[model samples]
Target: MLVDSHCHLDHLDLSDYQNSLDRLLDTARQRGVTQFLSVGVDLPSSSRLVELAQTRDDMLVSVGVHPLQRESPPLPEVTELLSLGSQPGVVAIGETGLDNYYDKDNAEWQEQSFISHLQAGAQLRKPVIVHTREARAQTMAILRDYASTSSGGVIHCFTENWDMAKAAMDLNFMISFSGIITFRNASALREVVKKVPLENMLVETDAPWLAPVPYRGKQNEPKYVVEVAKAVAEIKGVGWQQVAEVTTANFQRLFLP
Candidate 1:
């Protein structure tokens, strides 16, 4: 079975599913998507995600603020994040890291928030779900400083070059590709996928966004993660079964205790 290693279930546009999250998830299960990590973008969203996970056996959660919340309040203290992350069904810390691509003006605040999240993951002994955009170097540096095998994580929705992928792998972090890699212009990212070992790679939909080809320009769901996995297998010159089996295992290894 395949796991959607990262997604925002709380944020998905469920109008098409009769406004039913269960109907949406059931559709994904029919497509072989067995588990989901419904990511949180802030303290309030984290609380809501934890509640959502508790209602479904197949769902888990990650707590922490996203890097591009410029209009949002400053991140809570590390203690507060730890308190939230340690809650039941909360398996990871973050959808957090530096995103210079859009929020460059608040880079310092983002870095501070990222460090606190890294520390929280270490303290909780849970993996993190990082989101790095145009700030790869700084992101990696902070990760190297705070994260280790015991508190390792995955770089979700990875769109960087092989050098960055290699660097993140060296730090015991897995590289996860979203539906973006299925785009026609993502040949460079596909090349990165070829160079990275399948054992250290994962797949996500980043849903309600970045839907894979054939489904691009539409609302994404966990079922679409299969498309991302198919793309990865194609890039790595392997079968879809191998991508499904390995990436599912990779998700379990990182977020399942």
Candidate 2:
């Protein structure tokens, strides 16, 4: 079975998510996508994600502040994050990292928040759920700064180059491709996917955004992760089943590590 290593199951409109979740799972199951990780973008939603995990064994969660949110975060300290990480069904500590694509001016804050998250993941010995966009230099540097920490994490929604992917992997990070990789226009990303080794790779949907090729222009969901796996398999000239098994195993190793 395949595992969608990253997705925003809570961000989609409640009714829409509710309407489609079951069918989405059914479709994914038929398509060989058996498990998924529901990512969290901020504190409140992170809490909600944890709640969902309590009821759904197949679902897991990550907690952190999304780079896009301007609200000053509350911290009882980084221990709060470690405490959350210790909870059952909660596997990682991000959607953290940086995103200069949205607001370049917020770079400083994003870096600070991202570091706290890394340190927290270190403390908990949990892998991280990282997000980096247009800030590859800073992201890699920060990751290096904290390299001595926990095992490592995945660069979720990876859209960067081979060099960047190599750097992250050197630091022990996994490169996760989302639906964007399936787009006809994302040749560069597909090229990177081709070069990345399957043992250090993962697949995600990043739902509610970047639906795959045939499903482009519509909302994304976990079920579409199969499209990502298919695209990766095609790019790497490997069988689709091979990509599924390796990435799913990588997911379990990272989060369940």
TM-score of each: 0.98, 0.94
Worst window of 10 by summed lDDT in candidate 2? 71-80
* lDDT for 228 (candidate 2): 87
lDDT of 1 by residue, 26-94 (tens): 999999999999999888899999987878899999999998876676666899899999899999999
Q: lDDT value for candidate 1? A: 0.90
Candidate 2 achieves a global lDDT of 0.84
**Tens digit per residue, CA lDDT, model 2, 74-109:** 532477677777778888898788889889988777
Query: Counting only residues 3 or more apart in sequence or on different chains, how many pairs clash (N, Cα, C under 3 Å) in candidate 2?
Result: 0
Residue 192 C-alpha lDDT in model 1: 94
